[model samples]
Target: METTFDAADFHQTKLQNQLIQQLAAVEAQSNSTWATQQGQNSTRLAIALNLI
Candidate 1:
């Protein structure tokens, strides 16, 4: 009985850790995408200004 409970707890902890890692990865990817978009917009604006 004790062993079973321990195993369940370990499994739960492992799943939680995996979930946190996945969320962090997603957040990082989102930030990277946003940064890339911002950089592109800035470049376009600079080009437009130069055209004027």
Candidate 2:
């Protein structure tokens, strides 16, 4: 019984680690996309101001 419990606990911990890693990856991707969008927007603004 103890062995079975240990196995289950280990499996649960492994799954939790995987979920955390996946979440971190998603957050990083979102941040990169937001940064890119901000850069593009500022570039457009700069061009518009120069034209004016």
Candidate 3:
């Protein structure tokens, strides 16, 4: 029982670490995309206002 519990705990910890790393990567990508979109939106808004 002790050995089984230890193995399971180790595996769970590893999986948690992997999930955390993946989530961090996704957050970074999302932030980068958002920044790019905001810049485009500002440029578009400026052009539209100028046309008006």
Evaluate model 1: give its TM-score: 0.89
Model 2 residue 15 lDDT score = 100
In angstroms, how far off is 36's CA in candidate 1? 0.2
What is candidate 2's TM-score against the reference?
0.87
- Backbone collisions counted per model: 0, 0, 0
Output the worst ten-in-a-row residue range by lDDT, candidate 2: 1-10
- Candidate 2 lDDT, tens digit per residue, 1-52? 3445677798999999999999999999999999999999999999999999
Could you estimate the TM-score for every candidate? Answer: 0.89, 0.87, 0.70
Across 7-38, the per-residue lDDT of candidate 3 in tens digits comes to 77989999999999999999999999999999
Better of 2 and 3 by TM-score: 2
Off by over 4 Å in 2: 1-5
Once model 2 is optimally superposed onto the true structure by TM-score, how far is the C-alpha of residue 13 displaced, in angstroms? 0.4
* Residue 43 CA displacement from its true place in model 3, Å: 1.7
Task: Estimate, for each residue in 1-52, the C-alpha lDDT of model 1 and write its tens digit.
Answer: 3445677798999999999999999999999999999999999999999999
